[model samples]
Target: MSDSKSKRLRDPVHGLIVFAETEPLDLLAWELIDTPEFQRLRRIRQLGVSKFTFPGATHTRFAHSVGVFDNARTLTKVISREMKRNEQIFDAPRSEVAIIAALLHDLGHGPFSHTFEGVQESRGVKKRHETWTADIIRNPNGSIRGLLERYRVGFCEEVAKLLEAEDPQDIYHAVVSSSFDADRLDYLRRDKLMTGTGAGAIDFDWLIDNVRVAEIDIGAPEDDEPVNKVSTFCLASKALPAAEQFLLARYTLHQQVYFHKATRCAEHMIGKLLRSISTVANNGKNVEKMTGLRKEHPLIRFFGKNGECVENYLALDDTVIMGSLNALTAASDKTISEVADRLCNRRLYKTLDVADVGHDDGKKRQRQRTITRDFEAEIKAGSVMIDEKASISIYSEIGGDDDRTHKKLHILDGGKPVEISRLSDIIKALEKKEQFTRFYFEKEEDREKAQRKKGQNHD
Candidate 1:
């Protein structure tokens, strides 16, 4: 109850992260981590269905959150040293705001983390986790806001601003949300380690030592004259290789781990299961009796009309959802039971990369449509096409639509702030976005094979 024990955590990625219990700023992180809301993060996995593919990726957002805070703590030390020669100040108040903001940035993620948002959107509750995060932090009735306000008057707003990324060039906000910020830094390493992908090996020590506070070009968009400047973390020229490795690691991990076909299939099942729940809800049936869940169950409340408030959302996490999925295995509705059993038992859908269909894009589309139409009519399982093309590139010479955070991470060369893409061919090449289109469904051949194998094993 008291801050008697040493405020320390044994993180697998970041190692031992210790905070001085006596220091006000350190005390803030310690107290916040102990809150019920923060503790809920332990029930939420960092990678959602990633564990279905990468068995070791069962790590919680709680660990990642702590790691981000550790990164912010490390960056503050860098800020203290790097900004000493500059006009900027890394004071205690801003330092507190930065680290706390990093700690609580992913605070409002729903059940199954990011993928669950898609389910919410389909049902028309379109408010994102960020919106919920702001609501939770600013809410007078919530636990976090009171704790933040107790630290200092109006401190809640300051931390919220950092999370909102109100000022991208502000060094503190940069630490929270910049292109190469602590969130990315911690997750790249933490996810790599947890997923056991052995990808995204960055020079963590080199990056920390090399990142410096600097004023970069901010005039291209806002003014005709390239006169205005903004301050943020810029990479030292020597850390180019390290930065390149970091960027490539993100791409490789996305390809091999984050976008693993099995993981994507598992996530797809979750979305389908939620829709199936909606179907069951729409039918005039005794939902509680059919599903064997309480009238006030998280899933019921979530799918109900005018449902999914902050309190309901908070009450739902990976644990609750997993439990709900298990409960739905007993559901009487044929469609809901089928989807729920598939998810609960890990009989996930299969993926069909569009490239495999044909050499030409037209041929691929034609073959894809043929297979999709055939599968829809022929397969009892979900045979819907999951066509999606997303960019895997992590770096840019010039920032994209969300330009604020991406452009600030410059490379300092020849006493000038240059875009990192200009200095390294690797970075420049990464600027050209790469995309992939893939379809996901279950194959009858594979299903029959699995069933036959199971029968043989029993014999």
Candidate 2:
């Protein structure tokens, strides 16, 4: 790539995204961005169906990917400088791998982003978007994999491994997927700016500036030989408040934007539309036969016998799903057409927060579960269709499942390392369980019917 070929692009959320030929990593990133796989991100919305709620949230994954890459570059520079100051070696290849992983993190998201993943999950498909991302990165014929291979012997594999890391203590791994990772930092800031939410006011610049690599004990016995010390990311004691603010911002964003009631309803409706299309397409029925539409549906091949080929997966995007939905509005099948029409016209399903409707303490919580299940059964058996959508838990625990666990973020207090919860009561309180299960109905009358059934159960 020539210097002329590498140009800086202006971004609304992240200012200037520079691609300089002088910097090897930037040149490589530019090459990767030029490939078809990365370019496909331009067609996938960062927040699926969120535009229905927040008009300005039509930003694509392409922009988010570039923002993440820029954030990763900053984080890497900070960590590398700190390492050099401490007379430690900062591996350039490892840094490059982290940046590339951050850039391609959402590469395999299907049309409408997580909405398609939800549909796949409902169909008993265990493979998540991350799995597809890994597959795309490792696919020999994939443009991304080929580009990475030209950069280094095992560059592609290293990037995939970094993304697949489950260890909470690995600083490099955390940089790409932790609670305070580049991905979170970019998305929080970007989403807030685009949605006009004004909810995520995180001191990201202060937090990043205060980040330092520290050797902390991984909770091993003090007397153990060679002491189980690991190099992890930590915040200065003075910046502890900033970290708390970040967590609060994330929680608020989840509540106010990501998990907004209307957005969730739209997501559920799209999932239903996809499910209906896949069912009809896979049952030896063509789109023309089912919908009488003489258009080339992008989903036909993928939903056919050989389920989800690389070519089919690569060809899918938001436009394809939107086009299919437009065609389905006239589908011969009433269910398919109705669902598609609802999604197209923004007639989102009505949602009822079941968690707030009933109260059960202790082991009696089983009663709440019973009531919810009974309500679902009643609705399913009635003249209306409903889908149960649960909000992902936003709680941050000291040691919990997956990457979002709070154990990843450490704080240095009086030169002693401790979890952020130990330093801030606000953060500790944020760890409390906060999740809700919402029942979605296709029609207002159905929602009323479900509400009456809930009242009868309570009575």
lDDT, candidates in the order shown: 0.74, 0.74
- Tell me the tens digit of each residue's lDDT in model 1 across 1-459: 364555889989888898875677778788889888899999999898898888899999899999999898898888888767675565867877888899998898887765777777776768777777887788777788988888899999988776765545477767787766788888889888888877667889998888887777564564555555667788888988888888888778877887677777777778777777765554527877676567788777766666657776788888887887777878877656777888888887666665554456565566555555545654445555464634456552111233454443577898677877778887677675554566665565743443333212210
List, residue by residue over 10-121, the lDDT tens digit for candidate 2: 9997788889767877888888889899999999988878899999999999999999999998889887978887898887778888899999988878987767876787
lDDT of 1 at 123: 68
Candidate 1 Cα errors over 4 Å, as ranges? 166-169, 218-229, 279-285, 357-382, 396-409, 443-459
TM-score, every prediction: 0.88, 0.89
Q: For model 1, where is the 10-residue window of minimal lDDT?
A: 450-459
Q: Every model's Cα RMSD, please? A: 5.7, 3.5
